[model samples]
Target chain A: MIEKTLKGKPAYWIWLAILGALIAIGWACYFRQYAFGLGLTGMSRDVSWGLYISQFTFLVGVAAGGLMLVLPYYIHNYKAFARITILGEFLAISALVMCLMFIMADLGQPLRGLNVIFFPTPHSMLFWDMCVLWGYLLLNVLCGWVILTAERKQVPPPKWIYIFVAISIPFAVSIHTVTAMLYCGLPGRHFWLSAIIAPRFLASAFAAGPSLILIACLVMRKYADFDAGKEAISKLTTIIMYAVIINTFFFLLEFFVGYYSEVPGHIHSLQYLFFGLEHNGEVYNNLVPFMWVATLFNFTGLGILAYMKIFKVFDYRLVGTAAVLIFLALWTDKGLGFVFAGFVPNPLEEVTEYIPTLNELGITIGVWATGFFLLTLLYKIAIGVEHEVEQ
Target chain B: MMDNKRRKFLKMAGATVLAGISAPAIVKLSSTDAVASGGGQEAAAGGHSQSAAGASSARIRLGMVVDMRVFYQDQALLDVAIEACVKAHNIPEIPDRKSEIKWIWKTGYENAFPEHSHNHRSQILEHNQFAVLCNHCDNPSCVKACPTKATFVVEKNGIVAMDFHRCIGCRFCMAACPFGARSFNWQDPRPFIKRYNPDFPTRMRGVVEKCNFCGERLALGLEPACVEACKGTGALVFGDLNDADSEIRKVLDEEFTIQRKPSAGTIPSVFYIV
Candidate 1:
């Protein structure tokens, strides 16, 4: 079964080689960061978390998003998802790997990462995050492999596999919720302290995760001779549509609470992000354009999705455009804006701007390449098995 | 044979579930109870005696109170105290503001207490500066956020301490701390040390550090380095908060004092009197 990945066309090898080159470049930069300490990155004492942490946060959502397919397919008995469930699980595995890599890359003492397990503090959300993340990854790997093997054999999966699927649903939800708790539980960061953060994280994750899958399916259809069926795609598009709506609504609720209340603590970060904040009459605003772009893309994508759904019209081009737009919108909102916004008006009541250095960006690209490489290999094996079963 | 295999699988699953349910409780009971009971005995013993040896043997809730009125009058006193702490801790002097590591530093009143300030506040209050450091809070958010107990509260004393060897440098503790007390060693601190203190060991790059309340000095039956330097000026007072008769307790009872961001519910042991 593993040999299927080796049987790909020249295009597949080229893709693998590109990803491998990016990963090698990333590791070379990482070693420089390791030698010089985190000083090589753009993080300051005031803005302690930069690209690495933001990526970790975004990827956690991507990892958890696999549950959207798993829940409807397994619990609700949606038969259309059977062909693509393995894809979702494999996507989750790759995303989790990236999440862990980003964390390691961010650490000042990367070698001592095992200390989280060696001396666990249950009080820490990070400890629980570590537990659930590893547990979820194991569950996905076990279920995906076992179920795929059974499919190859043309037999029903073992009864125990059902338990794994049942457990993974809640586990997926917990991973994102715990990641949100990492930010929300902090006292002084008004931008993240809201109770709505966990729900917002979930909504955005649901939208982003399925959108990535839709794109992947499109790629698979064109290149790998795999089709997840139109019905499956339509159902996923509906899920994405509602999720984007809920995510947008939740984001607006944050603005309303911040602006209407007019608490400086609550409004300061939003002011810095949306409308440049004035500090000592020296107006400094870097995030305004990025945040506006995020807002425009999200709402426009939402409108497109809603219009299509309401009219009972299925345009693949329109749907694909919406999926890409929504994915980028959420990525910008969660990955780029949210993490930095929390650090603005830092604990000292000073606004210190953070922009990632080239070194940091290089490492980030490497992590993404690593994820895509794993995703490609997994999909190749999954599609090959499915094609053989059909024959 | 098939039925027997199914029975075996079900039995194994039941056992796994049972173990999973009971593990947390068992861990909680053993770890918490042992540390709590042990800490209790030490605190009781430390309270009865004010001797330095006794303080070392038992738990002491080390706290500090700064008299801002006295502190603002003499700028030299603050400098001497800062100098002493840096020298004692082997803290590096990174000229770069972005990467500088500080155990204790001076901050303006407005920056220290943003939530408490008003537009109508007097110029005197606005202009006054106060020395700030780790609060060693009763409910430290940093300790809770640390995935590894690398940064942990000393059960024997109320000092929030760090194990640099164990720290993974995730900076979660830095985010959790409201006072901006913690600093990361962004680069190797050894090269930047102007005058190396052979008494204290310097930390490697990539770990979070802050004021340890001079835990090393305290262990050696000595007052904190800062307290020693600020002596006779009556600006800084360090004592055990657990003992009602201690100077820190008396200062709290007599003067109207305020802790930085008391609304944060961290219950900072450091207080300020203006």
Candidate 2:
């Protein structure tokens, strides 16, 4: 079951070591969750969700973000995407794996998760979200794998797969949108109750997720020789810029609604998140200010990409810097109180705060490292396929 | 002294076991097969809708009316009423602090409604006393938000009922409800349930629970435990909202009464005369 080497150096061992360390960390932290229960996390009765769920939400969006790439490549016949569309699909599979892992970690009784499917309640957004994310995960993996295998063998891919990829675009959007509905539908929770939440979620996903893919492409080009060509790279950057614009626009609308409405419930959480209101006490501390800086970094990064003449070469340093910022900015905004801002000052006017504990932080790191390890392995096999390496 | 104390404890324990073993058989032998229905005249159509009952009554409207002004005078009475109801309903007392599971209790003046306060601590009177359990709204949003029909408004009498078996503990109902009526059970209930009440349904962990207006008691034509325990002034009144001749209707007609958070547009079945 084991494959030995890349370039005969047993590079797979390096990947195995990294993955093993992550799994060990995951096991150690998991024991704490079992012993202490959910109390170990920052979640309280008022703030039912925290960083773990937020990351799951963001990661699902990223998995769907691949649709923006997949659609143009398959449906519209964009030749530029042809070289690296398999990479996008591979990225999506990894994103889906991370999304599921986060969901599993968030549950109080991990064994009970099967109940969501067994007793399917159509009225619950979570039920739909569970179904859609799972469906999208399967479609992308199967279709992407089949197509990649065919390409490796110098054979024609089954014509039906194009239809599957085509079907996956809107289906992918549905996966993230349903996840958004889980929050947006609540009436009193001002932050999440927005009508624009589903759209905003999709927009952010497109920007954050593909931006990740573009970063991954750039990374591969540097360390390995999977150079998908400058033309393709330029095209991906262009798409990333456009997605970022959508993401920026979505934020603008969200901010406009928050400030203009003047409803204390709606406005207070956003204020608490950004301005550090109420003596900058317990919950709203260092990270609240970072939201503003995140907006700036995202805009500035998008601006650099938009103004093509400024950076003629598409320098790796500039790309990496901008990508890292956009990634962090979105992560902070989505994965923290930005999504939670709506829920504070609950209908009862009780302020329950959320701050991820050491155990929660450790569990999150373990999950992330596991995701990267799986991603590294998948990409290795894929690039090996493209290069016609022997099995 | 230690030997005497141990003997005393053993004697008490022996008596408790003797009572426990004989008490059930005595009751079963004495009582007939008939289910006890306390004497209350039913309307021609019965209390609740037959479709909802699937067995017993027709459409029934369950409701409550509390005289808040009078409630402010008594803390001991309120505690007794809540304790009685908790015992009758088999509700647990799990003490995680955060997940405070309460089927019925006093919400003193300030804590009951913060927006309506005239002074800093208007909710708490000279002593702790205020609004009683859930209002059980006519258009209960909690019912609307519950993905499973776990939490529902029984159509006949409009009692908000929770089917614990179906509940997934998503807490969406908690967020959607304006009254903050619902409570989540963070831990299992078995450890905390001190006594068994055959009339009321017991809850599981993670599912939401709240005041059910003592639907089981009302079904048997008995007043809710809270109503029976309120004593002297009789501050708590359980009745059929649809009946114009009921005491609840009389209070609504004569007194300048109000429902909690009326602006919420939930049209609460519970009313209060301050």
Candidate 3:
């Protein structure tokens, strides 16, 4: 089935070529960054983490969000998701790849990253995060491949696959929970020190991951001639509605606790995000505009998604726009606002705003391209196999 | 000639890898008696809580007392203290504060202790500077966050030290520290050192480093460079906090000293006499 990638039309090859160029540029930028050290980027001592970590956080949600599809299709035995379960698993595999790449890109010594494996500290949440991410990726790869292959051969998937599938459900939840623990467990950064962080991560992930899948299904239907059935698409749209609402409510819950309680630690980080923080007689709020944009996208996406579900309207174009909006909103919330704003008024109560340099953005783009490349390749295999079974 | 040189390089690389594997054992054998424990979490626990491990009575918890009143009288003393540590550790002089390597540095009082400064204070307290360094906490969050135990609390003396080689440069320790004590080598630091202290090994481009409380100087029966340099003003005092008769303990007995961010629950060893 790997041969399917080679069998694409000129447009497909052109897309591959573009992705290849981006990956190459990213690799070169990473090498330059590795040579010059992490200073090539805009990260300072105050804001030690930047775009790489932010992207890694967002992608972790994406990887776990696939569980949205897996739980409904396998556990609840929702027959509508049968044709699309493979898509969710494969998307997870791709997202996990991007998560890893972003993490590697962020490391100052990429060569020594294996020290985590060499001397594993059980106390560190990072060690657990690494373990669960790799575990979830392996589960997805194995299950997605074996089940898809079984379908292509016109045989029922092996019975043993169900055991792995059951284990994967909790494995999905663990990846995001441990990832949240990465920030929330830290002492000084009051913004992330919340019990609700894991829940917010999951809610945002559920909405973002499925909406992305909706767009991918539409793309596949138009390009690859693979329709995943109207029943499946509409059901997924409903899932997005619930997830987006829960996610927004979670954001509001954070605001109420932080502001209503009037705790300076909690209020300052929130203030830094939604409104600019006044620090040392100067207002530092570079992320303020981005946060508002995310808010605008969030409610707009919510309104459209809500309308579609409320009126029993299932127009694919409007749904696609809503999906794209919801995807961007969550990406901004998790990827940009969550980590970026959390670092403001750092441990020393000094606000040092971080903006990623072009060099950093180049590396980030490269990682995303590589993820798409893998996703496109994996998806090509799945669709090709589907095209074969249909004939 | 090129093939011959390649083979020669490969042989040397193999030898270096072999040496790397055995270096830990050699360092343990040759290092200070406490480092023989290699800063293990179990030993650190024994040093902290006597009942937990019933560890030896020789488990000394070193601490520092910074007399901000004395230091603030002569603010230049803060720079002197910083100079002493920089000279001792060969910390690089990077102009960028964010990426600069600092073993010991000064921060404003309000920034140092946000909880303590929430209310209006005496003008002296508001304007004064505080010398901040690693607390070598009773429960060090950096040690817990470090995925490879690159930064660990020494069992013998309760000094939190960094092992640069073991640090994967993840910067998790940086995020973990509430005091902004840890600094990452954003770039190769050798070029930035004004005057290289050959006595100390310079950290590589990609690693985290911070105050070891002059662990090497302690082994040599000398006080930490900052404490020694401040002997004239008598602003910095270093002694075993566990020892009841120690000067640091006496200072705590007499003065109304406060630790930075007491609510953080790290139980910092460094105390400030406001």
Candidate 4:
């Protein structure tokens, strides 16, 4: 009882209060979406999908980061990651929740989402995607819970927990690949209809995902007594660098195919996405400049990381800046170009632009804030539990 | 003890997976075997076959023929076709917007005949108003991609039918259609029910809709609205291709014709004479 009482400082209450306020604001916005139909969104006949899908794609990549820690710790027996596996599992739970929230926000009738199960369409890639996401989430949640319970009870975790972790590594990769198949299977949309799209998504996801974990490690080290070690950080960044290199290669290959074919229909979409199409000004501007900026950030951050001497200064600031830039670039590319630009010169060869309305923007912000607030509360509860057990 | 539990768990999982994968295949194969047995019994008993009775009309091949010459200078005729369709079908007016339910629309000389280069190009430009609708292709791509049995090419009538209720709104049919004939209602269209087309059914939001070749009117011994409204001067001809003496057959025998976007390999039922 005294351990529980000692766990919460005044600062914990402050963080909790701040998070509660953000949750309130986000919930108010969610209510507004229920009042109005999907007309509140920027989606139209030309561009049926918009911001919600883009957010979902980004969050799924973040969730895939859990495997980065889990794979090394379990299969490879990297003892350094043992203490941090709980943190990774908790982060996976938060990321999966955000992914589900974004998808639900994008649906026409959020309540009818369960119909996906009642009436399963095996031909739809979405059904497979849903199964993979739910499976991965449950795998991590169960793995974390059983392990943590054993730790608190001062006993070895059930041997079956490692089996779950072993299964989850490949399951993690499958989750993001199934997500990529959602767009890659379409024949007409040249931008998304490539075989390499899933690999590219995984590459970029791994790159940005590990960078986020590295940043989280730095922060926890500073505030808490958790030191994940410099060697682990270095090793994680090296893996991230390889992912970035592959991601850059994919971007170049996509451009080469588009320009080489010189097929007006295929080339026109890339031109519209990267450089504005004839007379359509700054429609996909956020995508073109920001994507290149992302490439530059990845290269520059990797360059900084290459120097062993600079390892001493590899604190939250430098790692945080790199993570923000990489995350921002990828988020813009997937959200803006992947969703809206596919519709500019529609199948009829008519150029109709899609711009999200105010209501859509409001609801999107609410969804994001809700995700953040939920993550904060979950982290607080987790950290508090860890402290109580330690005492 | 823990190892024993793990091995047992693995065995249980393996059995579950094996059942999941093979159960469907076994069911599918056994059903086919039953059908094969049923066919053998029918053949042995000498069943009264469908082909023996009314074998001539065994396949009702539905088709349409449009004459461009009558519509060359008649805007009133085109207006009548559109208005008559709107009235007969109870199509709601979109109010300065184009709805997915358009049964008729006019195309200019350049768009209508991109390939045909006649010596009388000036004469052709002076008079050309072509109304375009669904080609109702013989080898339709739209029918191939529909996940549900929502969109299909009817074997008996040679017409395409869209079952809206069965549509999961995947919109694969829309992207597959090369002609851009399909339309998706982004928002609720039922509230825009100022005027309703009784002959043609209104569609819900999220599902796709297109010109169905006026399946209701074709059920009766009458022509489609657009075909019937073709200036009443043989601008549009409708008849069975199977009937050698039909008006479509006479037109095909007399005039040289072209189908839209022949490169697509759709083999359209609608034809145009230059």
Best by lDDT: 1
The TM-score values for the models, in the order shown, are: 0.91, 0.82, 0.93, 0.75
Which digits, one per residue and each the tens of the lDDT, describe model 4 over residues B240-265? 55556556666788898776667666
- Worst 10-residue lDDT window for candidate 4 chain A reads A1-10
* Candidate number with the higher lDDT (1 or 4): 1
**Candidate 4 share of real interface contacts:** 0.09
- After best superposition, candidate 1 residue A188: deviation in angstroms? 1.4
**Which candidate, 2 or 4, has the higher lDDT?**
2
Please write out the lDDT profile of model 4 over residues A1-391, one tens digit for every residue: 1143235556656765776676666567667656555555666555656777777887788788778788788888898776676777777777888888878776654565675686565666677888989999999889887887777676888997888888899988998998888777654556676898888888888876677677767766766555667778767767776777788789788888889987665676778777777742434443466556655765676665554325545554665566666666666666566666666555445556666776667666666666665555555555555665669
Residue B37 Cα positional deviation in candidate 4, in Å, after optimal superposition: 38
Q: Which pairs of residues collide in candidate 1?
A: none
Query: Per-residue lDDT for B99 in model 1?
Result: 93
Give the per-prediction TM-score of chain B: 0.78, 0.75, 0.81, 0.71
Per-structure clash totals for the candidates: 0, 15, 1, 6
Which sequence of candidate numbers ranks them by lDDT, best first?
1, 3, 2, 4
Show the colliding residue pairs in model 3: A45-B98
Tell how far residue B10 is off in model 3, in angstroms. Answer: 47
DockQ of all predictions against the true structure, Cα-based: 0.61, 0.22, 0.60, 0.11
